[model samples]
Target chain A: MNLKELYQEIILEHGKNPRNLRKTEDFNKDAKGNNPLCGDNVHVYLKLNGQKIVEDISFEGSGCAISMASASIMTDLIKGKNEHEAKEIVEDFLGMIKENPELMSENLDEDEKTKLMSLSGVKQYPMRVKCATLSWHTLISAFDENKEEVKTEN
Target chain B: MNINQIKKEFPIFDEKIQNNDLVYLDSANSSQKPKVVVDRINEFYTKQFSNVGRSVHYLAVAATNLYENTRTSVQKYINAKDKNEIVFTKGATEALNLVANTLGQSYLQEGDEVLITELEHHSNYVPWHFLRKSKNIKINFAEINEEGEITLEEIEKKITPKTRLISITHLSNVTGAILPVKEITQLAHSKGIIVVVDGCQGAPHLKLDMQELDCDFYAISCHKMYGPTGLGVLYGKKKWLEELPPYQGGGGMINEVKKDRISYGELPNKYEAGTMATAQVIAFDQSIKFLESIGIENVMKHEADLVEYGQELLQKNNSVKLIGNPKNKGGVLSFVIEGVHPHDIATILDEDGVAIRAGHHCCQILHDKLNIPASARASVGIYNTKEDLDQLNESINNCKKIFNL
Candidate 1:
């Protein structure tokens, strides 16, 4: 409902020039997600080391500002964390976008929480909550090695 | 009738949409129902609600007559050769599926080709795709020119000796390109190809004449024509409708059933099985009358003028790129901002109570051909005005400001 809150300065900047928007070299896991309603799509790639620590995370897709910026900021914060930390952050972000007021994961620092909170404006726009969560869900699919494509219909 | 006066007939305009006057520009998605059509539904339910074509009760007989009257009205409206040619289905999707399924059962052979264009909606293409999977029929696409039009020549070039049917849209919902349906139908008929039209976008905006266009089958969405939902009209040549197998089998569509064999009812009833959308079908007669009262020619002119004005306004605005520039266009105005995604633009515009569509508009093939994920579209109806387009432009500016464009 509030345009200023929805399209914040940081969101706009990240959407225009998305970060880590490329296929990670030697990625071990990847998954594709699509919003069939709007035709927005995302392909999440992850490169995890032998120790199961995240070495690289990136995405390749086109979408609305909320989606692109969410994916860009997600990859930026999730690159160095281990698999457990990355999954916890994903759950916390999805929770906040769904209903919770704030992030609830101990794995994420205050700066990381603040960066993710900018996308909380999507909660008011129920049709767009899928836009903010598609990449996160796809990243989870990548981690689990689920080959089925994720479809965000709700 | 004046556009302002026409707008008053739709009661939704009187109510504030989020504290702003509703600038509804999504008619291509579905049109707003007039007071007459809405009140007809209420009146039918309140006073004369009865299941049609059933018992010998007074209301059932009256309701049956009323239902058949609407069928006659549709026949006259589309200028079909026989009233039996017009069959009511659940929706345009169901109508098109009925054609594809019946033809696949009786007429189409394995390895035969069904030609469709890039401008077809998923409803037009997906049903034929079922034939591809089950019957192994080949589906060919007629390419679109740079102007986003599916020309008659494109149809000609795609036709082979194996081509058995050609299905296409009467108007592109995304590009606003009005396909040359009449000429294409003529060409397809010359080559003995069946032409089925997805008239969801065309029925509401263009003047329809089945006898003149001479297409073998045309599917119309009633909701898009200011009628109620859950009802659609399919106009097929009587011979084809009689010859093709029945789509759905139920109580109404049956002539008789035995352990050994079953007989189906006649033309229209065979297509319409079970209980129909009784209230919606009865109410749709008023929608046809509403169009007749205003006259389709005037409606066409008003929408054409609005699209022209909207096109010029957006073309003058910086960073706004209108989608297609076909010589013959409809009421659609699709565009993309250089630095803004269509979803962002649509959300920002919705805040100003400018309701437009932002998506593939069910034409993913056309969007893929255009090489963009999605685009925003603002389509007009009989009630839309130049001031509505002006409000749309102002909202687009607000979106640009929010995106820092």
Candidate 2:
């Protein structure tokens, strides 16, 4: 309900020019996700090295400002982390968005947590929480190598 | 009665929607119910509850008479020749499916073509698609013009000698372009092609006269007419209803059942197989009376004015692009902002209790043709006022300011 909190200046900037919004050239893991109700879709691509460190991560999709910003911030934070750390960060972010007061991931710095917490406004609008979380769930699907596309519910 | 006074009839306006007075602009999705219609449902269930079309008890026969009385009311409302021509279904979706399934069973043959417009809702398109997969039937789509209208010319261009049926919406839900159903039905009948209308949008606002239109079949959504949910009316010609097979087989639709052979019942009971939505059907008579009280012509005029005012308001706003410019439009006003996504706009608007719809509106074919993922829509009803459109315009400005447009 709070428009200023939901459409923060950083979120709008990220939505306007989302980071790494392209197909990874040598992606090893990938998965698709969609919000069938709103026609928003995303494809997460990851390039993992031999030691399972995140080498490169990118995505391709079209959606509203909240979704695009969520995906952009996610891809920015997820790069260079190992598989275990990446999954933990995903869980912490999802937990914070759902009910927890703050990000609990040991891997994320204070600045990174603040950037993700900017999306906490979505908690008030239950219908829009899915828009912010769809791309994060799709990233997990990519890491797990799940073949089925990820679909979000309210 | 004054059209503006109609808002007082619906009690929802008196309550605050999230601390904001309800400025309902989503009536095209489903209209707000009048008190009479709502009270009728409660009265029926409270004191006069009984299963209709069965049993010899007093309440049963009384309920049966009440149910049949609604059928007669609908027949007179739509100007149909016979009362049995109007059959009750679960919804407009089921009505369209019944037509497609029954035609697929007896009338349609393999390799035959069914013509539909790009403006059809999923309910109209998906039923015919089932026939395509199972019977090798061909489904053809008539393209819309730049104004987002499926003109008579466009429909004519798509018709073929093998086209057995033409199913289309009486009004485009997204574009609000009212199709020339009567003229199109005339053309289709001349070529021996059946015409089935998806009147979900049309039934609420338009003047429905099945006899004058002469279409093979028409489907109506009662919820959109300020009636209760779980009820719809299908107006098929008596001849077609007699010829087509039953859609769902159950207790009521059978005349005689045996181990080896079973015979179907008469026209309406043949289609209404199981226990129907009796209370909703009975309450729907109040909805018809509601419309009759205001008169369709007055409703049409009021809505037309509202749309015109809404169109003008949005057109003057910068960065707001109205979707269609059809000369013959109804209550729908679909648009997109250059920078703001429709979902974002809708969220911002909802904060002010200005209810509108955002997405494909179940006409993905039209949206795909328009080459956009989705657009926002604001549709008017009898209770909507010019001030509602003004509030909508002010909200759009707020959304643009938030998006830094």
Candidate 3:
């Protein structure tokens, strides 16, 4: 109920001075994603060194605090992970937000659970879940293009 | 006039949201249904549910009578010349598109012009845009004055010898400014240009007579006028309807189909293709009756009173900026607080059980012209009361406090 707690200093700082906010111009794979409902758009670029993501960078164009912060944190999390590990991270993030099945098991580590719990506020607002995950899904599609794999249902 | 008595007719007023009474103020987008309309649909399914005008069975005959009676009701509702001029469409969007596609294609030449205003909704804008692209016709726009009212001078300036048609909104959904349709139609007619009026907002608030207004075509949506969704009325003059070709080709709209050619049906049926929205059409009759029983003059007076009350209340705060200043406006009032974004203001209002619309309102071009990202709109209807306006004023004041503006 407290908006001060909802929009904490960490979220504001990440939103204001986002990390990895640059275009990968020479990157092999890139894709543009947009949430048509809210008009949030993000262009994700992936520099993959033979399936291991060497440099994962993104630049976002959005209107809200939560969406920009989510994009910042997602780009920071998957900067150096390989494609397989990045896919698992996306699945974990999707589970935390959309209540997907993988994270329902009670086997998460303390730090991983804490990191996922940062997005727990999104569960209360269904309309905002897409805003929080737009950048992450775009990154998934970028990696899919790099690996020459067709995307499944979003 | 009694809030409690009127509240009893709408079931949503009794429903609780977040353990609080629901205050719906999005009637400009779509009005909530009264019990009469809801029960009309219920009765049709329970007793007389059947497709109309086809079967010889008893239910079909009864359904045909009910459906044809609705046509008569609508003909009288808008004071059209004949029932044949009324064609049931999906909604005003489709109705406007029906006119634009058929008439715009048949009459408009490569160098001709279609004159519209900047205040048109996308439904009125995009169809003409498509026509311009396909037919190589030029689209001209009349400018709005500082008061958000379109002037006769502007319309005259925009019209030329090549201008073939003039389509405009009867009332602006954003600023609630009522355009002078009768004068504009007369001017357009004198210039030998046909006129089409988007009556989605006006039909719900004002009294309309197609003959008196003398507009060649008028598009109306049922949902905005307390009827069901998926049904709208397009009132065109019989001469124009007879001249224009069929909009869509399908089963009911045609009389016969041969190897290469086909014969079309009668006046209204020629334009209405496929199986119509029967149940919603029947329920639309009840919505018409509901409005008729209250009388449109009373509805207009009550809404005008709310508009004046809202203007007096909200404009007291220095932070609130009212959008338009027409001498004759509708019940809609769009405004923006000084520092807070419209979306944030809407969010805070929603937490306090106050509903409003906050966006470009499908008028992106108008927003671009006004150079504002968006504005918050509070529109009124017959079901609304002074208490609703008070809630809106209080909630907007709370938004100012929250933003420390």
**Residue lDDT tens for model 1, B308-370:** 999999999999999989999999999999889999899999999999999998889888988
Residue-level lDDT of model 2, residues A41-129, one tens digit each, is: 99999999999999999999989999999999999999999999999999999998899988989999999999999899999889899
2 versus 3: better DockQ goes to:
2
Candidate 1 is graded, for docking, as high
Tell me which of candidates 1 and 2 scores higher on lDDT: 2
Q: Give a tens-digit lDDT track for model 3, residues A111-152.
A: 655554565666666655666787778888887774432222
What's the lDDT for residue B327 in model 2?
Answer: 91
> For residues B223-294, what per-residue lDDT tens digits would candidate 2 score against the true structure?
999999999999999999999999999989999999999999998899998899999999999999999999
| B1-405 per-residue lDDT for model 3 (tens digits) | 564676689888888766666667788899989999999999999989999878999999999889889999999999999999999999999999999999765888888899999899989999999988888889999988898888878999999989999999999998888999999999998879999999999999999898899999999999998899999999999999999999999878888899998999998889888889999999999989988988899889999998999999988878899998888899898997766656556666776677788778888778778877678888887889888889888888876665555
For model 1, what is the alpha-carbon lDDT of residue B272?
89
Model 3: CA > 4 A from native: A1-31, A42-60, A72-89, A100-118, A139-154, B317-320, B337-341, B397-405
Question: How far out, in Å, is residue A105 in model 1?
Answer: 1.7
What DockQ does candidate 2 have relative to the true complex? 0.82
**Predictions' DockQ, in order:** 0.88, 0.82, 0.18
Q: What is the TM-score of chain B alone in each candidate?
A: 0.99, 0.99, 0.98
- Report fnat for all candidates as fractions from 0 to 1: 0.93, 0.72, 0.00
